[model samples]
Target chain A: MKVTAATFTNLSPEWILLGVVTLLMLIVAFSKDKKQYLAVTVAAIALGFSAMCAFYHMNETNQVMFMGQYLITPLTSFLKFLTCLLMLAGLLYGRDFITSRNMQPGEYAILILFSTLGMLALISSNSLIVFYVALELLSLPLYAMVAMERNSGRASEAAMKYFVMGALASGFILYGISMLYGATGSLNLNEIAQQLQTTAVSHRVIFIFGAVFVVAGLAFKLGVAPFHMWAPDVYHGAPNPVAAIIASGPKVAAFAFFLRFLLDGHNGLVHQWHDLLIVMSVLSIVLGNVIAVVQTNVKRMLAYSSIAHMGFVFLALLADNPIGYRAAMFYVVTYVVMSMGAFALLTLVSKAGAEAETLNDLKGLNERNPWLALMMLLLMFSMAGVPPTVGFFAKLGVLNALVHANMTTLAVVAVLFAVVGAYYYLRVIRTMYFESASNHKPICLNWDERALISINGLMVLYLGIFPAGLMSLCQQFVG
Target chain B: MIQQVIFYLFAALLIFSGVRVVASRNPVHSALFLVLAFVAAAPLWIMAGAEFLGLVLVFVYVGAVMTLFLFVVMMLNLDEVPRSKGFVRYLPFGLIIVGLIVTLMLNVIDPSHFSLHVNAGMIVPQHHSNTKELGLMLFTQYLLPFELAGALLIVAIISAIGLAFRGPRARKVQDPSAQIAVKRNERVRLVNMEAEKKS
Candidate 1:
């Protein structure tokens, strides 16, 4: 194929999303209104348009865009679709919070758009520079969003900690890239792989060092054990909607990038990094579950749960088999749904201008709003990997892949951790059902919040019952 | 010959500043010394033929970022930093670690190992240096990772902004939101304007 700049100019659905976001940002900045309904409407339209574009793109075959740097494969398209969907849900869930705070709705829309752009770039990135740029594009906006609640000292502290640790990780990643470039004299993944095939491993000491550093940098993003110190703080502090986006969308994108860079590009060095990943996964699973048990703060507990979930994803990555990759992708998709639903309920349950941080806040949720309680039940169950919910299928897929890869011990450990994880998730359910309301006020759900929560909750059940279609899509991409 | 002289001079300066950074009693002075060390090291990196790293080290670490660090250090009251007498207990372990690092560095340093001869005959004019080549490579081949680093920088910037802009309470200001949202029209208005004018 004779690649040309014109080939790169073909407007993908992501490009349409970028345009919509930019346009929405401009409108929000310029327009004045007592009610910022226009901003919300525009954001919804843009996200919807992006989702439609992703669907359109999915029908096409894998092809390189932007002169082979950006790829538009089915995998990228699907992940982008999922990211856009989650962003839309988050914006809807956050509408009340944004309005109550009197924050610039345009800024929120633009930041989300920028994050979407980053996620899109991350999924499609074939080159190292593009990948890093995408990662930043996604992350930087998130740091701002974390501190968007300007009056909250907790938010500021969380944003600061996340930012510093993130910077150190970036520095590590850059140093690794430099070392890799120095060793291979090339940056293209295929070219580097070809070069490494001929080069003796012992002769490429810099390459190994670079690989380790790069993986470490990626581990920081994945929030695996030892690199996950910031996750709980950030999650506990960030607004529920922002936390939802952080815990779900960017995480999935990061894992996609990890699969691309580590599993695909540096597949040869699997033996070198697999043990490290194993250690990280094991530690994340054990510590994440154990610590989460003691947390009264619901958000903090979920944050710990996320770390443990990431461990399972890392285990799949360590498996380095096609089934494992597929399972990981499926697991991530389900996780996004579960997290979005859970956080949506969190947003719905809280009163206007207040954050729902504690388990006590969820008390009497079942009596106040049974439907929302039901949604929360499904989400928690999904997260706990219970049967007839998407969470179970997600876990089953991962466990099956691990067992298939002859990782019985790791699978056993994962099963044990899953059992541990169930406790924290179920604690919320218990709080809602078994406990009485501390305050007798019925929780009100907004139209957008209701719609998002219902969809997220139902999707978990729908996917769990019939995971074949999503599994097939994942299998096709990996194949 | 000029390049070698510059490299050695900067290398010595870097080491001197690094030692000073560690030994300086004042935190502000230590920060300044660290900046000096970083600045000196950039020239050494340039001499090692890694122009990209050299320029970035100066531009990012020394010029903008380190200055900001120095400002923050200077702004802070360093009396809060713990001055423990228990440091003597850990001094031996620290020294052992340093000694091990020095031995490792010595073992790795072989003059013959770095003997990849540069093609001096093919040197480009200073006006047409390898900056363009570097930029092309950065944008094209390494585009993903390059962009990811840029995102990390944005993250850093956001973090810094968050840290610097402590809340109104921290800054000893009344809540701006409360003040801004107050309906001033209700509190003050012109009643009987003509009578007021006559008065």
Candidate 2:
């Protein structure tokens, strides 16, 4: 509980990350205006150094520090490490996009790093206060980044819309937290859980209402159906590189928050929340997929697809077992990789002034650049949960967990929705292969962007074909 | 007692000002009414012995935030926004929603229907002052959160700068720094010229 040397050692990842943030600012301040290339180098090393620190601490056993403010375990450490890798991939894919748009590279890289730090803090937080602040830390920079393309009216509109809705959601969460505090008189999750055990039935109802508010707020952040109204607009409006980070980075962190809050804090009332999650899960999958089928804008379609994908992740949590947790972890990790791959290709194909986003943009892509088209096909296949891809294994893992928990009917319903979802992903593939572009010019991609996409695609296939090792590894953490 | 009467006065005025805040046609009036509502609510907090919170509500929110609200409201072209219409037509639906919410609030708050006994009346603790106790706890156990709040402020400032402040765009005057880039060979050319005749 004291501020000892062990506390410093245990939180070295965060400390190193903080140092990198300061170092980044100094580098930006000292550098010339034309030396924007250094931003990528600084960011890469910052992410690498922090990831190394996290990886170094990966084998550590669970330890509660800062008087239970942060609870670092092997799982949180491992997820932080993976998130750093994902951000690194995002940066690589986005490097050319940033260069073309003349985005302030220092600003872009630092926001990404700060958001990553927020996620790491969120992952390790054991108290609601810590989690909430970390959530704000993650979102504040993102709002600004979403509006970074200054010339576009749509970008500013998206930013304003996101900021307002996000504030409302945070209000809901704070109200819920206040109500929960009134009921239990504790902000610490463990203490709340303990107090909840002896609470009367009437107080339990109050707690349930509080928990509902909390879930609704979180559902907004995760971009589930009904609360997912902002996602399509934001994704379609923001610059491609920023949109990629929005889709990948925050999603993984949101899933981490879900695990921590539901499993750790509200696990005592799992029965109450299980039905709530099911309703949201079913609604998200059904609505997200059904609406996605009609979308012509590629980015908007992917946004809806993300909603459905989130629904599947929620299904794993529906069972609330160790196996279910592992399955959810695997699903989220793979989904991030697959989405990153698709968006990277989208970024690569676009020029600065003309963003390539519509279905027409992909027409005859196969003829223009066969390799790029193939990668897009693979990414689409993975998203559609087709065979020999990570997406298939991810869905299969969650469904298997559902079946194990005796939810066959839910599993069947999910599979039906997955079939519906496949239609949209296949629509993308069909556009790429079956049609020819009216205004055709081949995409010129830098080697870095191309190599990043290739590695991302290969990762998806490799994880799909040999998923057992990672699956069991996830199981080892949650089990 | 006089305390009960005063409490009722604050509550009644708060409700009145709160309604006017939403119903006022002029945004400037609405902002003023909002400040009034906040002022009314603060007295109730003071009556509960939370003097620090009550005073903070007045100073931080009513004094500063409401003034900012007025400035923002006035910054917009007020002539562009037409006065709202259809108040009577929408009244029935609004009433229904209000009725539903009142019922829901009553359902949860009715302690007599359940054994749950929330404090319906104010009680002042005798051992310590309100602000003193809060300061003690905030400085000790909640120190990290207090620091994190400062961090949130920093984020807000940075975001505001990033999103809103693009420095000095669309200069009507020629930039001297840009003019400095002109070279003699680029800006001027020397040529053999024919002498003009007097015409």
Candidate 3:
């Protein structure tokens, strides 16, 4: 408990992230020049440093930092690495859009770094209090980010809706945690589980209610049906890069936390929660895919698509097996790649005057830019679960895990909904290739944008074809 | 005895201010009353043995956020609170919900089922400090959830930024065609005038 330089050294990664974020904030505050690239450079360097720290910590076995609230475990390290990479990509995509719109890049970068730090903390949190604090920390900044486009009414509406729903979800989660604490006289997940195991099932109704409420709150975060009302509006209203981060980073972290809390801590209650999850999974798959088919706005379509993907991931969770956990992780990774790629392509295709939100904007995209069109094709195909793309394998992994767990009916429903999802994804492809180019000139792509697009597109193919190693790693983690 | 006195005092203040917050006619006054409620609630949190939460509530809600709320309310000029017919219709439902909650609490805390004793096992000793024990338990046992909270905070931050930076479509005044078509000559015109001698 003694404060010393050595103790600080033990928390060097966290310090490093905080320090960089602080630096970015200062730069944003002091620098009058809007064209300053220092913030971007600092953000990139910080991301790289975090990645390195994560890599270093990956092999470290169960080292608790920050007086036990934070941990440096392989799971935390892996998630931190993935989140940092996604943040970096998001930052790159954000740069041109932010700058073009006269936004303060320094503040934007700093907030992103701080948010990323919060996410890392959340992923490594050891207590309910720490978890809630981190959740709030991550959430408060996103409310601001969603409202960052200060003048847009839609943006304001999106921010308002997101805030209200998020607050309600937080309330639900807090109430659940409090009820759990009241029931078990403890907030620790391990202790709660132990207590539940010992206590008579009839006496644990409060705990069960708490667990249900907590899952309901998490479902809101996951954009599962009955609580997914805000996803489409928020996703469509926010900037594309922001939408991409919303779709991937938070969803992945939420799933990670869900697995940690539910699968690891409450595995005994699998029978209790499994049916509920199965129901949610089925509803999410059906509703998300069905609604997405009719969306004219590209962002809204992807938002629904993301919801469907969450359903797929939920299907994996329903399996309640190691195979299921690994499949879920794989699905998240693949989904992130495809979602980022698709959004990145949208950013590239959008001209300065026009926002690439509608499907009509993609008309004749292939005629203007073959490379982008091809990239879009790959992403759409991947999303549609076509072969030779990562999405195909991602879905296959989830289905296989579900089948292994004797959830064949859920797997069938998933595949059926996936077919429904394919229609919308392919609609974009058709627009990109089959239609004639509009009279307007195609948007020019910057080098960073092109690089991201290509890498994201290629990753889908690479993972689909050579997924053995990654699958094994996931399996190891799932174990 | 002192702890009980402080708890009751803060609890009373919290309830009074919370009522005022909802019932105040002016939005600004309502926001101010909410701040008072939050401040009072912070002490109640401390009484509940959550020191961190108490401090956080004071710092975040009472100090910073409520100030922002006050500012926003002050800036927006509203003549009066909008009276809605829906409020009257929902009043019975609200009261019913409140009644149900009270009944539930009463059942849970029935004196016949459980008695409060000074030396009961459930009560902590006067000298016992919860913070240290809480810290230990949180770190040693509830580690993953603590980290997951951190990730949730990050997501919150991202969502906030997204909300703030949402583009203003209706108010935006950019015509790309006009901007792209403006020639250099049009932007930089050289006008020459002949000067005549005036007597």
Candidate 4:
């Protein structure tokens, strides 16, 4: 735990993000209107550097820093890399959408940088206190970002609802942590795990009681059903880019947060939390799929689909073994890529005074722009878990984990719900290809978004065909 | 016996203020009651030998935060909330839920399960400073959390400004660059004009 130059080197990713956030704040403060767009460039470059830093440290694992309250591991570093890519893509994809509407891109970029910092910190947090602080840091900016569309009443309402529910969730986590601390006399995850092993039955009950609240808070963050009341509204109401950011990076970070808190901290109480995850995942799969079919708004539909996707992650998580965790990690990374591509495409189709909010907005997209349309087709197919796409492999990995855990029935149910979820994603594809254009205007995208979206969309197929690389990487980290 | 008496006195006052905080009809009254609750609880903490926490709680919560709360309550121009008809309808269910919660809390906090010796007093080590110890820990063992909390505050400020700060759209602010970059001839036409009389 001694501080060293190597420790700083190991923590370069977090330090880079913190430095970038500070830089963005200063830019936002002094920059003129014409120069404000520079914030995006600055943030994107910083995110790229941070991501590179994370990738560089992939081999250096189990390096504890900040007095054992921060940890570095292969899995966390990889997650940090993914999160940085997510933020960078979100800014790149969101720029045109935000600028077209004359929103303050500077503020938007700074907020995203802060949120990225929050996510990185949350990913590496080893203590409950750090986790809670990082959670707030992640959330506060998102609430503002959701309300970025200042004129939209829907956006303001969504921001308010998100803020209130997020605060409640934070309260739940704090109370849960307090209870756990009371029971175990420690706030560090490793300490808590060790304490639980020797604690009495009464303390165990208290730990379980505290853990229920913690799981509930985590469910809210993950946007699983029974506590997913805010997702569809926030997604439907926020600007396209904001929703895309929320959907992509935060979910991955929340998954890491889950692993840190539950698996790392309270693994001793797996049986107690297993029942909770079972109920949540089942509800999320059924509800997310069944409700998504009726959603006319594309954002709301994606929201529901994302819920169902998280259900699959939880299914993998419930296996509670290395293979299960590895599958879960693979599933989350692929899902972030797919969803980010999907939302980026949505931003492309959106024009001034006419957002691509409905299915009809996507009608005849192939006639308008074949290349973008093809990318959308790939994303939608991947989302529906069609073959030759990453989503299929992701689902296959989760199901394999489930079956390996001898939960064949659960796997069967998961596949059934996935089929139900496929209906909506396929509906999107049908709207894009089979139907004719209503607007008849060609979809336009800048080179940056065009190239990024193409690469993102093709990744599904690329990883699907050669799943070994990412799969083995996940196994290496989790194992 | 005297310590027990003092503890019971403050505990009762704390519970009374706490109930009043919820039971008060006016928000201003409720805020005052909350302040009272904090005041009552501080002495209870002090009686338990955590005098530093008690003093800090009074100074921060009562002296500063509650005053800010009162200002907000007065400025918000909120109307009196009318009682809803559904309140009476839900009374039975609410009472049942309350009873269940109380029972659960009692089960969890059953003092009989704990081994407690009701000593006459808590022994405080000579020259032991709670504030100094807490400060040392905050700067050393707990520095990460302390720093992260500061970062969280900074995030809160940024979010508040980002969401609530209405800049050029709300007010006509001066551009210093434009002011400083002004060309003398362009800004003021130096055309020779005939001297006009007072008319």
Top candidate when judged by TM-score against the true structure: 4
Q: Which of the CAPRI classes, incorrect, acceptable, medium or high, describes model 1? A: acceptable
Q: Residue by residue across A163-257, what tens digits does model 3's lDDT show?
A: 89999999989988887886777766667788888988765777776777788888898899878999999998887777777777777677777
lDDT against the true structure, each candidate: 0.79, 0.83, 0.79, 0.87
The digit string of per-residue lDDT tens for model 4 on B35-140 reads: 9999999998987778999998999999999999999998996666566679889999999978996787677655533335412354668989999988988887
The list of candidate 2 runs beyond 4 A from truth reads: A26-30, B75-77, B83-104, B112-132, B168-195
Expressed as tens digits, the lDDT of each residue in A1-479 for candidate 4 is 35678977987887787787888888888888644777889889999999999998898748887778888998899999999999899998888788778678888888888888889988998988888888888999899999989989999999999999999999989988887886777888899899888877655776776777887898899899899999999999999989989998888888997987778776667777788889999999999999999999899999999999899999999988888898899989999998888888888889534888899898998999999989998999998999999899899989988988999989999999999988989998899899998788787777888899999999888998999999999989885
- Candidates ranked, most accurate by lDDT first: 4, 2, 1, 3
Judging by lDDT, tell me the better candidate of 2 and 4.
4
Q: Give i-RMS (Å) per prediction.
A: 5.4, 2.4, 6.4, 1.9
Q: TM-score each candidate.
A: 0.84, 0.90, 0.83, 0.91
Runs of candidate 4 exceeding 4 Å displacement? B19-25, B84-103, B112-124, B169-199
Clashes of each: 18, 0, 62, 0
Residues B1-199 of candidate 1 have per-residue lDDT tens digits of 9987997898899899999888777888888899899889988877766787899998999889888988888777674345668789999999997898568545433332224552123455677555788888677755545645654564455445543553335456689888889997867996775554654
List model 2 lDDT by residue over A1-479, tens digit each: 36778878888777776677768777765677643678678788888877887898889889987667788888888888888888887777776677677666667777777778787887887888887888888888889888888888998999888889898888878888876777777888888888888878766877776777777888898898768889999988888878888888888877887788888776567878888889989989998899999999999998999999999999998977888888899988888888878877788888523678999988898987888999999899999999998899899989999999999999999999999999999989999999987667777777777788888888888888999888887988886
User: Model 4's CAPRI class?
Assistant: medium
Candidate achieving the largest DockQ = 4
DockQ, Cα level, model 1: 0.25
Better of 2 and 3 by DockQ: 2
Cα lDDT of model 1 by residue, A1-479, tens digit: 34465444334555666667657655765677734678778887788788777777787887865556777777887888888888888888887776676555556677787788788888887767677777778878888888888778998899889989999898978878876776677766666777778877664665776777788888888788889999999999888788888888888788888888777776577787778889999999999999999999999998899899889888887787888889888888888788777876787776433567799888888888899989899889989989999889888888988998899999999999889889888989999999998776777777766777888888888988999999999998884
